[model samples]
Target chain A: MTNISRRDLLKSSAVTAAGATAGLTGIASASNHGKHNHSKSKRVVIVGGGIGGATAAQYLKKMDSDIDVTLIEANKNYHTCFMSNEVIGGVRPMDSIEFNYDKLAEKGIKVVFGSVINIDPDKQRVITKDNKVFSYDRAIVSPGIDFKYDEIEGYSKEVSETSIPHAWKAGPQTAMLLKQLQEMKDGGTFVIVTPPNPFRCPPGPYERASLVAAYFKKHKPNSKVVILDPKEKFSKFGLFMDGWKRHYGYGTDKSIITWIGKEAGGTVSKVDVATKTVTAEAGEFKADVLNIIPPQKAGPIAFETDLVGDLDWCSVDHKTFESTIHKNIHVIGDASIASPMPKSGYSANSQAKVCAAAIASSLNGVPMPDPSWVNTCYSIIAPKDGVSVAMVYAYKDGKIIKVKGSGGLTGPYNAEDRKREELYAHSWFNNITADIFG
Target chain B: MKQTKLILIGSALLASSTFINLAHATVIDRATILANTCAGCHGPNGISNGPLTPSIAGLPKNYISESMYDFATGKRPSTVMQRIAKGYTDADIKALSDYFSKLPKKATEPKKTNNHHGHNH
Candidate 1:
């Protein structure tokens, strides 16, 4: 094929040269984005459609043209693992947090709607629950996390399935929990039990309590919210306490929500799903509705693939995201053990981009680019008011560590600045959601 | 499995590159393993004297390497560090830490402020 398209290519290359003059960057040329020509293209199979998997699909498509990506998700629609707490409080419509795979499909990501029953790393093939098999050159698993039902006594998956609901993954159960909260009468007690450390979203349960109380303060007025925890403090304890006080009469007899750290006799020992009661070291409290977000581990695929060692999360080459157990397999998002990186949507999205670049470079003959990343996690406290922690990182000394003079928490203040931060946080969330899914 | 990867990566590094890092690397010829992008904020010599920055020079090589290893492995979580260290190796970390640790601390006119905490040992 004596393609005179070279002339067109040369012209476009000149246009690209001109665009570069204006600081515009296009798809890395090594990637193949041609029509029905994926035969020679490299394939990246991403498992799970949560923050990490979804963002990886989008960013991988964005960074290169030739990467044929197939995203495997059991659910056709994904209700965000983030922001489900707000749904419990009836702040935002559950529909607002729900997403379809259409966006990824539009971006050329092949959506395989089936549960990944097995990950054959050696074969570089994934078998789904539907008995379908798809092979790839590389596999990226970001299967978020699963709860450890056995960790807490009297509370297991079957128990939650029938009566008490974890509502952690935020689907029908999230709606069910919200419905239960809505039907509670005045002066009713809302009990939220939080799990011990090494869980997804450390500050999530507290935020749920705060947001639920935010709803109750306006609607029920006499309702009380109690938080029984396994930890002494949380991500933004001081800020949370201040915000609670300002909004929900916290620290007062009339406080809408009361948080009992472990020191305050809040460690939960057992739960009775039938009676809707939680027995903790502090006291045995019964609630009209119980929301328990449990401790987590890397999803079943991570364990089944033998990716995780002693830890419950996958071990990866922090720089490349390649799993320690398998050469061509990379694990990102909440599934992998990225210690210095939280399992938040934003962090997972950021990680996916870096991993995509590395994978692309490795696929081609070029050396990997010098990887740098930025992350900011935003939490909605009292509606538009939000807070965030932003940082920029560089790799050094063979490990990924923070560069000084870069990152800091939002603030320990309760002034106008914090409110402004909330607005910024909301904007950041909108931007990030767009950056990840849109 | 981690041990295997570390060993495999170590042998790969040793087999691939002949040069090793010493005290300080000049801007132009920083080794591929050294990847002096760390110099952007930590200082060219690994010692940070800026008001808000921590000094990293003269720290034990493993200490420096361990910190990075934590970030890379997710024992620690920072927004940037996780992304930056997503794809590094044991040899790379060792080489980079030695390069920075041996370099003389960056020179600056010292100021008397709350440079109080020595290091979070």
Candidate 2:
């Protein structure tokens, strides 16, 4: 061998070291070294134990036994967003929607009872409000949705402290609304203002209205409910209308429910808090009780972590549910920008499974399997009368897209099918709660 | 003549898979086949060096299949065992399941090594 400079020797040694490292990966000898570069097992930390986060933890554990995973949430219990409407309508108690994380902890997962206040993607670290800093190889954020208080005038979180309540997040406020409605007189009007598009649970408000009407017919027959909505039509509206007609004498002078769409100026222009009257595009509507579902975005933790973009939703790689902004950090649920997939608990649960599978693959340095998701949203026009629309979704052309020919809407306002759907809805809730929590 | 040619192509393809199976990764389903390879690190009778490696004796056959299938399907990620299992056929997995199920649970002393990773159940 010819004599080489010391500096040259150092450079050659560095190259050799890198080559040796590459060879251990099992794909270093291939011509296209850049195509696939596998790494070692990674530690994945997921924030939020709601439907999405919990489901992801289960899936990831099922996928990989070696990956170290930790799930963090502010609350130990999660109230199901899908069924929370029934809680507010007094059909189901708040306990009906609540679920614990004990099942997840039993599955060899480390469940952290703390609020994630900050996420530094560059460092791959998550900082809790209590100052517990955790470094992770990958992280998933699914904090769910929050109401935009400013969009509705004089309707702030503080305002809801006493007089008016949004009850959008679906906890104490939900029970408060139901209690307020129960105290209203027989002939008094209960005004509900539906917010604009891009809100949680697209079918939520209608379900709330239907359940509340069911209660009114039983307790106070003369009480009337008016739904001022921004959208002209809604999911399962035809079914809801049919149920309303059958149960509450809708579409006549003796109707117990009145739903005015944007065309009829149903969308509220402003809320005058002192008078307890809402000024809509139609006119000022006075009420004994007001339930305003304001425009919503991702929850506060998601915004605090810088996971949201210009659209007030987290940007994610549709295929893996991994965040596009923060490397190795994934976002799912209502907070994630997954188009064609509505922000429903079922969608969140489904996305969680796909995310779990992907996380396992990335952590193990293996090939990620193709992912597909299923979502079914069930609503009750009455306790025993229900309707739902179910769909299967898949990623196509680099984004989450609905799988055509896989799902269809409920049939045109049928009574028998609606009744069957209600039974199925309750069963679906139990199965989903068990699937995510149990 | 074209039909004959197509038939020849299909027959060749079928014959090649048979040849590949025999040579590429021969599946060992018989007790004798697994007794030699797996028993070296694991126990001859399905016991292990300790809790460091899981005791596979008397495990459910379906659970064994699912565990092996998960390893094969990339659903359950592993490091060393993943590569070790890459060669196991479905039949071999079933056979291993049978062998492990028939064996009794026995324990042995843990081997001292450089890596100190261990979780006590």
Candidate 3:
């Protein structure tokens, strides 16, 4: 009840005034040390060291080196989901996509490898699983997406781990799925179950299907890849259909890749793990390798922090990314609902920078600068063939709107252009990882 | 570094000279924020690591603005730049050109000793 009034106050105040209040709070806390004490460096604690959290940490330091930043992540290393599809398709090693916080630490960000148990908005502190309490003037949570395992019958987290692989989080699950695909019979089917909309990486399922088909075509010519979708269409639909038709005999009797949209009874209701069968409205599919990507919501940490109140995702201010539900707490990455901007790693990284700038300015009692964001998601369809969709965004009329005529899909598939996009996609991975963890 | 010293001297000169760029100072800061988004693929300071994504750091101011103008106007052939370029205003392009052209082209690649995961398309 009090938080509603606080949110109203924040909404009514000028941008700098909200930050000025935070600045005053910093001074008030620091002056508690002694009567003659000087103001301490403002402390920012970030939970979840994914693309958004990592980028915010690094950029906050860059904006003002005097600010003390501490980043807490559960895992010592991060396995990026962006290019993990390449690993699943056997185009690159898993180690290539794996990154650590060593570079972020080198930038003077305190990288703590521990699970965050709680973020107390009232106390302005973050509590870890081991009872470690970190006080902060501001906090950012970038907890990525979590799956609703119960959405499908006979499928849960345990089943996803051991039997059917989601491989959405891009770690051992990826390796497991890859091993199954490799060991599969040459004429067998690799079934991929697609999730609904508002999920991380909108085009991810199609990309996975493309790469797997490529793998099957090379090593097991008689094998096929089947995608059962819950939606009528997907990201870059035309581009993907073209690529599939050109390379995988899609729409032909000998097609290696078959896409069943919702209209075609692609909505799956159950999976028989014991028999490796997927039951969709279209029909039942028996497969040698099954990849089930279940529906998703914000990660557990977001829910644990009470950031998402009766919603699947966190609500944030378009300009500052500060939570609309809570004060002084910002959420970015896949956990926050940023429509018009797909939940891609590039969008997370871009949002992180804007969020960081807002936090930095707010802490210093300065007006938040105007914000701009851009996202370019590149997906490799097959070797030497990649496609991309890009957009530039601006904050207008209290909402994030895409700049008209600014972004588009990769033009008509020229081999040279496709080849170049593939290269850029790899380079993008290199540069973005470097920007975040490096 | 020499760059910092030059920047300091430049600021001192700007303070003494006509306040022509005073109005542009905030615009420059906004442009810097806009430009930071490019580092995801272009690398920090616009010095790219990948062969295809060219380094735009330290290029001539005129050249940078001209190229961006071309990209925005569809005169230049680019895979993603045209879409990206059309997003910025002419003022943003000018400010970005001025900001990036002044920085050194070189940036330290993140320390990676063992993992060399560069794969060809």
Candidate 4:
């Protein structure tokens, strides 16, 4: 029998702390010695180091010390797309939202900076762009969302790069959009095109408009934000409209922000890059600053791996988040078909935990437990004026469904309530990021 | 001799019951899985170090169970908990309450104060 030392006991206790301070040396020695008495070491490979991928990696190691986890991400730093809207409004610096993988590494999760070129489910191996192959007993893919630039005419990848900026990915495009909004002349029109349903962050476009309006209210008084949305109703529509009327004069002609839903010809088909104009079904609208958020589907990696079938998003067993098409592969976050759960950072984080638990149990040859999922999306309308919607879900009748009489919006809008919700929003961000990254 | 046999049987039953209790304490499977979801905000095992969220570990099982019932039934007003509570059935809530109430209480430490940027969702 292998003798366990005091240091080993300390290491084991630290694992209960969510593996935040657990050292990689302990994991290395365990694998080298094969101390767990398993027939073979179990390996888990996670693609993408975003919220879902990173959380899964950390939780997997925390749940079971014997499993080897390798996380493959294309970028060294991951900038969250969730709060990038605030960056465009000049509320936060780019570096504030950027995160490195060093903390995950400290938790004994191997972080590999490389783009995955292909995944062979039959062979249970993932090949990276640099010609490296990682074999895994189970693999998790969470590459996030990619824009379908072809959905809109006269708007291509080059156009998005040069003249217009989507700012959806929370990086250079975000910076570019900020620069344009800052440089626009007073009273100049700023047009934002909202994508269709099943997009990331259902309330994102409205929140973007609110933040931009807040900026215009402070910096450029006469400037206006015109939202051209394909969908008629949006998440928290009533609350947003109420907040707009209360804060920004929504219904008035001199209102700083104007929203044209699909009923009002808000469906944009093409963009005139030279004129800085977008042609919607209703009419042609020109803007000094054009921010067109195009339609989206699963990320490119999903396509490369054939994880997605005829549908744009990959389908998974609602209980375990395991891909229905492929065995031993799990898909989570925005890339998977998780309905009733919007594709938000919080949703991804929640899904990651459930997936992590399922993966850990499966590896241990234990029965998978009943799963529950939760999502809360809080949007800041104007600084202290915030509103939120939350829901808890459970696996029922072979599908994940929302539990009725559960989640509701922030009741009875008041200044004190809004302020508290805003504080909670910020605290939630801090808590969740620390949970996933650490 | 009959008395001795009776005593032996009694001792064996007691030992088996004790063994079962020990197994229940160490083996965390379904209950842990369900309760871990709360750790995202409540802290590990419901010992929330954060000021806004409360620590729920080691509370009376009846209190925890009743509070969850209130949230599920809309008797309690909540921002997120109401929705989360609705997901659980009465039986599930009982199991969770029982599991969390048995955890050893830990002192609440102040969460690391950091200037957090961005909206998570």
**Candidate 4 per-residue lDDT over residues A1-438, each given as its tens digit:** 113433355345435432344222122212111123322336789999998999889778777755679999999988888778888888978787888899989878889999899999998889998888887778999999999998999898899899899888877888899899999999899999999988988898899999999999998999999999998999999999999998899999879999999999999999989998999989999999999999999999889888899988999988889999999899999999999788988789889888988887766555577787778888999998767888877788889888877776877677866876776666566567677775
Candidate 2 — which residues are off by over 4 angstroms? Answer: A1-38, A413-415, B1-121
Model 1 CA deviation exceeding 4 Å by range: A1-41, A412-415, B1-121
TM-score against native, each model: 0.71, 0.72, 0.87, 0.84
* TM-scores of chain A across candidates: 0.88, 0.89, 0.91, 0.91
Against the reference, the lDDT scores of all candidates come to: 0.68, 0.69, 0.82, 0.78
- Docking class for candidate 3: acceptable
Model 1 iRMS (Å) reads 16.3
lDDT of 2 by residue, A203-251 (tens): 8888888888888888888888899999999887777888788878899
For B1-121, candidate 2 gives per-residue lDDT tens digits of: 1000101123344333311111111111233223323432233344544323344667787876777767555566432233345445466678767767766554443343212332110
Runs of candidate 3 exceeding 4 Å displacement:
A1-41, B1-28, B107-121
lDDT score, candidate 4: 0.78
Task: For candidate 2, give the lDDT of residue A350.
Answer: 76
Cα misplacement distance, residue A342 of candidate 4 (Å): 1.6
Every model's DockQ, to 2 decimals?
0.02, 0.02, 0.26, 0.15
List the pairs of residues colliding in candidate 4.
none
DockQ winner, 1 or 4: 4
- Compute the lDDT of residue A152 as modeled in candidate 3: 86
